[model samples]
Target: MLLLLIGFGSDSNKGNKSTKLTVNETFVTNDKGVATISGKTSPDYGVNIDNAKQTAADSDGKFSFEYNLKGNSKKSLRLEVSKDYDDNTKKSKLIYVKPSKKFLANRESLAQESSRAAVASKSQRKAASESSESQKKAESEKAKVESEQASDITRLSEKPTDEQSAILTQLANQTFSKKYPYKGSKIHTILGNIQPWTKDGNVWFAKYEATIANAFNAKRDATLEIRITPLSRDSGNVSFEDY
Candidate 1:
């Protein structure tokens, strides 16, 4: 009977050793501000961290829990484990945790990059606005110039001055000479009466009457229409068509 009691006592000691809880002494917080506490305990044992809610170990006697540092640089954790079959509860040593240096550095770098991107975006928007305003201003000036030119053309076509009339007569004679280059062909008086017509606002057509003698000495009255296109305020292009 004494030998049997000794063997039973040794078995009890082995059971207590197998149920002992073990935990990591130190942990580091990740970039997400969370620290993971892990430990080994008896299978299906209830594990508690810092007196919080209890969690059960897996079948393999492994357990883990995440603790939020709440943006703190350092934190302390205590853990306890208990099994239904064991009357004695096991406790772990104080666990220390600190934020990882690599995490902090990466966070700072990302913040700086974000700040630079924001500045660049603001500058781009400002530049785009300025460019748009400049383009609008240029377009407005161009429209004003076009309006003035159209007005000038309308005025000139309605009532030509003496100098303008002389220029028109010379242009007409030159055009007639090109078309009728016969050796003895000659033109008499170009018409004094000029009637101007226009299709579009920018161009004018004027009809004139004249007398011309061919190389055969046969004389006939001729009618011609001239197209006048203003090149600028002081210059124009002239073309002729027989009417």
Candidate 2:
């Protein structure tokens, strides 16, 4: 990557912006022999692969392309970078694509890792659900003891304030946006319901459901739990995680 940057600089005029492109090691392949190449480049740069596949960078200069290497023995690729299809301003690089064996191995490893993660996530959600159930059960059992002599009573409060709702929504959006298909695909996060209950007054929890669509076109949904601990009347710390 550094060598490519230096070569680009040496080949470009001083006043002109040097063609800067870096291919991160995010290449992946499957048994079908198709490779997905992803990386970043200078913003607004036009990228072409072997003079066939072409794409323009996003506002942040990130780019991704999928190339089918099925049944091809040749392992080299030509990456050409330019702006507005100007050949005179193009910088080309010869990239030796990694062998399919490496990509397959990596894909297998990733599949295993994803399987493990799904299992772990399932366990975590189950545990959280059980914990919440037990807490509710304990509270119900304590209701008998909360007679006239009880010190204080827990209460169900109204919906969160605008500020609190905004903070929670922001946190949820960020968390959901960082997840899979939603990370890149044009997806909207629709927050469903907010259920908040408080005891004493310091710690509070708000549970909500979010629907993510892009990969499945709104057929899937996810539940999130947000914990809000108020430090004062107007401020607090908010944290959340996907379940």
Candidate 3:
């Protein structure tokens, strides 16, 4: 993609001006072992390589020609341009040529190496992606277990409701027995509904009412308080007092 031009001026006093030549390309090769030697020269000069005649310069002092190379290794192709071959001759630079088989093998080897590197890079990326996904899954399972444990602790800390009615009623009756233990008075009736329990720290407390009858068959209502301490999810200890 580069262009260069040189000019020569003729002097009328001088018999004939020296012809100059300039090459456009440094080296070239094709599949058929044919090399193209092209350049520009002064008007009316015959161009040749190693004394083999080629095309003459055109109106714009431009000429191009082809020569078939006959060698299996590196060699130099020489160009010469002259009007008559004695002293006004111009020679071109030597262009080195490489063997076609060696050039093709080197090209193929480079291509295969590039392909293998690409495949290795792709496999490494895939393995990294899989490892990342596994780590994320493990973290998700750990978080879920921690959340469930937290929920269980919260439930244990709150007040109990209908699920605890049996324990509350039993504690109320036991409270009446221990406080008002009149020999003539016997247990009469216990109320079905009881007051809700309250929690402070790990202790539970409740207040309830019950009725007692004397030996004369007279009934009276009594108030009782109960306290409970839980040891686990399904077991606890209870204590009662009368008010």
TM-scores for all predictions? 0.41, 0.33, 0.32
Model 1 lDDT on a 0 to 1 scale: 0.67
Backbone clash count, each prediction separately: 0, 0, 0
At residue 170, what lDDT does model 2 achieve?
Answer: 62
**After aligning candidate 1 to the native by TM-score, how far in Å is the CA of 176 from where it should be?**
36
Candidate 2 lDDT over residue span 1-243, tens digit each: 455433445322122347667774334455566777777777888888878747878888888777776443546777777778776566666664444676566667878999999999999999999999999999987875553213221221454444445554565455445654553332233445656433325555666675545665544566666665655443455665655
Query: Which parts of model 1 are misplaced by more than 4 Å?
Result: 1-26, 30-34, 45-56, 65-97, 153-243
lDDT of 3 by residue, 28-65 (tens): 45755666767787776777665678888886778877
Every model: Cα RMSD to truth: 14.8, 34.6, 17.3
Q: Give residue 209's error in model 1 in angstroms.
A: 21
Candidate 1 residue-wise lDDT, 1-243, digit = tens: 455443333211122454666777789988876778888887888876666655789998899888777554677666667775344655445677788887777678888999999999999999999999999999999999766655454345555655555555566567678777655544343444456444336666677665566678776666767777766554467776654
Q: What clash count does candidate 3 reach?
A: 0
Candidate-wise lDDT, in order: 0.67, 0.60, 0.60
TM-score of 1: 0.41
Better of 1 and 3 by lDDT: 1
Which is the winner by TM-score between candidate 1 and candidate 2?
1
Off by over 4 Å in 3: 1-99, 154-243
